[model samples]
Target: MENHNPPQLGNQLCFPLYVIAKEITGLYRPFLDELDITYPQYLVMMVLWEKDGLTVNQIGEKLYLDSGTLTPLLKRLEAKGILIRKRKKEDERVVEIFLQQSGKDLQQKACQIPAKMQEKLNLSSEDLLELKETVQKILNKIQK
Candidate 1:
């Protein structure tokens, strides 16, 4: 007969990953607060900053979010005058997101966040790169 032990929290890989994700997001909180945005909002802004005029569906796909979760975030940003959501004339169903001048200006301030986070983390460049690569690999495998 084979015997199996019950699962233990400490022995699970997910616990540390969950903790790390939460802690890292926590680390970004103060910085994000200064911009009057949250981590998820910052992620959305980052995507828009990289390329403007993306449809809401495109944004959701890139962020691994759904319309239900993303719609409110977009609405909030629009209310804050950071972005604008416009419906395409050709296709009313297509909602595109564009940065307002304020959003573009926000990018100037946000440019410093990465360096600040790096300083706060105190991880060597090599270590940071390795960690990012490892996480990306894991994420890729999970997605597959």
Candidate 2:
């Protein structure tokens, strides 16, 4: 097969991964609309849920996002009343995110999402785990 052409569309892996991620995120759009947040905003909320009061730098680190992306996204989330942004008391230069009562309340609605996503994808848990591991391996390699 050395002389043969490389694998085409049907044999490719990355194309499907990219397409599926985009499509799946699209699926969440309507539901996310009800919450009045975009996919990136939802991601920000999830991160904040786990650890509130993180500096913009810290949130960007976990999300692989930069200030340019986080700043505007955080602003929108703040405008929606889900989060509050404030300058840190100890460091005036730093901005930290704090979840408001509305944001905390959002978790209850957000809990329904995972189950719906699973039903939509219809992938078995084992398959999902394997895919996650494979992607993690690639991320590790790329990071190193």
Residue-level lDDT of model 2, residues 1-144, one tens digit each, is: 365787799788889988988998999998898888899999999999999999999999999999998999999889989899999889899999999999999988999998787788898888888988999998899899
Specify the highest-TM-score model's number.
1
TM of each candidate vs. truth: 0.96, 0.89
lDDT of each: 0.97, 0.92
Best by lDDT: 1
The residue-level lDDT of candidate 1 at 56 comes to: 97
lDDT of 2 at 93: 92
Which stretches of model 2 miss by more than 4 angstroms? 1-13
Candidate 1 per-residue C-alpha lDDT over 1-144 given as tens digits, one digit per residue, 9 for 90 to 100: 875988899999999999999999999999999999999999999999999999999999999999999999999999999999999999999999999999999999999999999999999889999999999999999999
Q: State model 2's lDDT.
A: 0.92
Regions more than 4 Å wrong, model 1: 1-3
